[model samples]
Target: MQKIGFSGTLDPITNGHMWVIGEARSIAEEVVVFLSENSTKAPKFSAEERKAIVLASCAERGWNNVAVQIVKSEYTARVAKRNGVGYLIRGIRSTADFDYENLIQQTNVEVIGGAKTLFVMPPRDLGSVSSSFVKALEGPVGWNWTMKKFVPAPAYKAWILAWLRKEWDSLWRERPHSAEWFERLTGEQAYGGAERHYHNLDHLVHGLAEIRAWAANTGAAPAHVALVKAAFWFHDAVYAHAAGEVSNEEASARLWLGSGLEPDAVRAEEVATLIRATDHFQGGAMLHPLKDTMLSVDLAILGQEAEVYQAYATGIRAEYAHVPEADYNSKRAQILAHLRGKAEAGTLFADPFFTDNYTAAAIANMSAELALIAGR
Candidate 1:
């Protein structure tokens, strides 16, 4: 059976809300609704009241297959991860909503690592219905004016009353959390408007994949694994490609601390260190105790040990396909030279499995990739 989860404050249920839930039900055998608690910046509704309204609204439609409750704490992603719910559900009504929702989904994937997102578009008729509009006395007229046009009267009344008391606005209009904040502040340009040579969705996926490979090969200590994974996310997070001075270690550490991940400050710092160690020009003399795994990851790419490296290159080429070939060639050359030096010096990666074999594999792979790129 599929276990699906729903999040958000239901200050008032709107036709749009119901439509998403219906879509979720069609895909999974069970739908679990977790009401969001209003933070200082969110709307002002108690968890219990929101739960009641959600249950009442679901009952009106005989949605017995769904289990409704409040999601505790501000860490909704953590809560959902603990529950073993793989998919986080949301409904999109317009292009604006899609942009915001996309960031939330991206952040969850970053923090949780394994979760996926499912976006269900609102039913055609209820496309414009939203909790914010329902709550605004002037935004949209009587609930039935739209409800009868899209939703049942009872459900519509339940939705409006929930919002009338100002409960739903708690989660709405709040400052976005981590990933959301990143997307809002950033644009298509990576650094100095150089068009971002690296650090894209593909980079993130590659980091996670390398971490996964390391975890599988050596079963590294769990704490170390978590730290490494988190580092994979924060590293290169502050990319200013044009300046060529981004600190995967320093900036990522600050990001972790700023995001309230201070409890693991030391570990976060270590990961940042590892990220910096991945710098092609950086040598092993400055390596730290965590250097082995970090280097292993860096070499995993520098050495082109697997198809992952090629994939990374392919993504970069595609992203900058518009750039002048001369510019691409110059940047690509510097990157390859950096990789070659690291591999040649036996410092590109730290091999945890045997201290030699893993490094050897990486060097061999990277050599072939470098040669291929040069010939091209």
Candidate 2:
């Protein structure tokens, strides 16, 4: 257990890989990660880039006992022998993994003679995570939160920043914007404000994911999906810090209106209308499927699991912490009660998609939260 080896291409390291590393770290004095370079492998990230990322991830977690060795065209056992590492850590998440890894372990110890393979499995929640899975979440809908859970902190940071750049580049592909506009939109003045604990870029990413999921379910055309996505981008971009006269939604919509994402002013207006639906207090119903879809998606967090709901509520409370507690509690109670009432009336979600998935859970979360506020 003095020295141990963990080997993989690790095109990019993931949380699950970190789990196994933690296991090796627990027993070993030093854990050396063998970042293998196979001639035939076409990895997403180069070896040097992956090594820096892995080292940064270790730094992020304050894991000082870990080290890395770039293995070029060498066998794992030979590397282990060269490094004087007696044990190699292998992850087994399933019966198939066990069957495969067990064979390898036997071969390494009995047949190969240089290293003994120690098998470890992550907790069931992390059982399925792999680099391939993490890589696949890059451009997809509904993956920012999911990807955050799977990737290490440093890699996640790199990933989200990269994703933001790619997203904006795609947004402005047809209609180009200055570097300053991109910064203004994605940086602190907009969604990335210091005051924003929630409603930030990640939230926008989640909303985009949800809408695309909605599109896939409803078989929405590319145009409609694009319109809804535009609405999502500008919906919370001007959150809370309104310029005195206009509401946040109006401010955000005005930005969209000026931007030529959609040449048609009418469609731009539709995006605006959809953005306006995010204002929970404005009781007027927009009453179109697309609008309702936007509304449902905007509030979709309400219908998520208790943990996600709690996180959402906590973020909302954090954002409104400047308000006097009594006033904040009172105002929040009213909104929660209104939602509770809506839930009881089976009108909590406008889209049947969300209505079916989130209705009961949303009601339950609101009711529990309301009880806490009342008691407080």
Candidate 3:
């Protein structure tokens, strides 16, 4: 099974690129789309954002064989060679595109031994549509229906949601207590905040999914489940970039309590206790059943498969990017050591669900992370 590579900035994936990816998928067993960064061009979107857009586009179009990756190197040839891609796929629109790509093809072949370049013309209707042209439509005038036609539907929806985030205040005023408002506020704090990397909306969503699964499995009461859901939303709402300096759980709890959204004092306290229980290192006395469940769900990431755990570690490091490597590693090791101690003592999770399913894997992940941090 030969892997074909397609490398592009993909700042905002266009319809043309989707068509080209579909064409490439037909020609190769696997199509790897390298979201390459270009030093010469100022990207409208970050590398991570572009990769996500491409991935979403692939998923939307049901391109099962296509995979999206963010290239560390700006050079496409280097990306192809690193990924063991034998052929580089390029989409050519016109004579000008052919001439430019022809030069690139020769250079790539020269730099990467045994690498071949394949050019495919996009559908005639979308041939001239490019990311640059699509970006031009996004100005003070804002995106219109015509602009939506040029880009993938998922990309356009993401763009519109991002645009809407800036106008959240107006939207909030119009629909207070609405799910959209709740999502917008949570999304802003989690995904749009500067410090968040791992404790983002995606993490919150994962927690919610786990909580729901556990609740259903255990036949938890509706009120108890609702409190758990609230705790999930506020657990990492106020993430602290610096380690051991401040308590994000406490801060997040306070934010939720003072938000004028809580039903009553008792319920607020329950949710607050649940959020604070996520402070795994503190090892405080548990007061509520939901606390045990929430804590288990929060630490579930530790029990994920190796690749998922690695990704979580990477995101945590990114969150603490401001800290020096040595300092970060030392702090991280201390945290992991505490978790390891709990796991060793058989007190990591009070909930049977987590004890039966996650305890062993969590301990294993902690041990691996501790060893890695020790070397650093």
- Report clash pairs, candidate 2: 142-209
Candidate with more favorable, higher TM-score: 1 or 3: 3
Q: Give the TM-score of candidate 3.
A: 0.55
Local accuracy of candidate 2 as per-residue lDDT tens digits, 55-159: 999888889999999999877877797779988998888999899888877777777676878888789888989999898877654567668778887777666
Writing each residue's lDDT as its tens digit, candidate 3 over 127-206 gives: 78998888787533213334667988778766655544443332233434645546644565655465677786446555
1 or 2, greater by lDDT: 2
Tell me the spans in candidate 2 whose CA falls farther than 4 Å from its real position: 1-3, 26-29, 37-49, 70-73, 79-87, 92-99, 102-151, 156-174, 178-195, 240-245, 257-270, 277-289
TM-score of each: 0.42, 0.77, 0.55
lDDT of each: 0.60, 0.81, 0.75
Score residue 239 of candidate 3 by CA lDDT: 75
Answer with 2 or 3, whichever has the higher lDDT: 2
Error of 2 at 58 (Å): 2.1
Model 1 agreement with the true structure over 1-376: per-residue lDDT tens digits: 4878877777666667777888888888888887777565365346776676677777888998887867665556667667787887888878998999888888888865645678888767678777666555322212223343444445454443433223212221343364353342233432212455445533444445566666677777877776666555556566543443545445555665566543456655666666666554453445566667765654454444355455556756765777787688778777767766766686555564424545565555556666776776
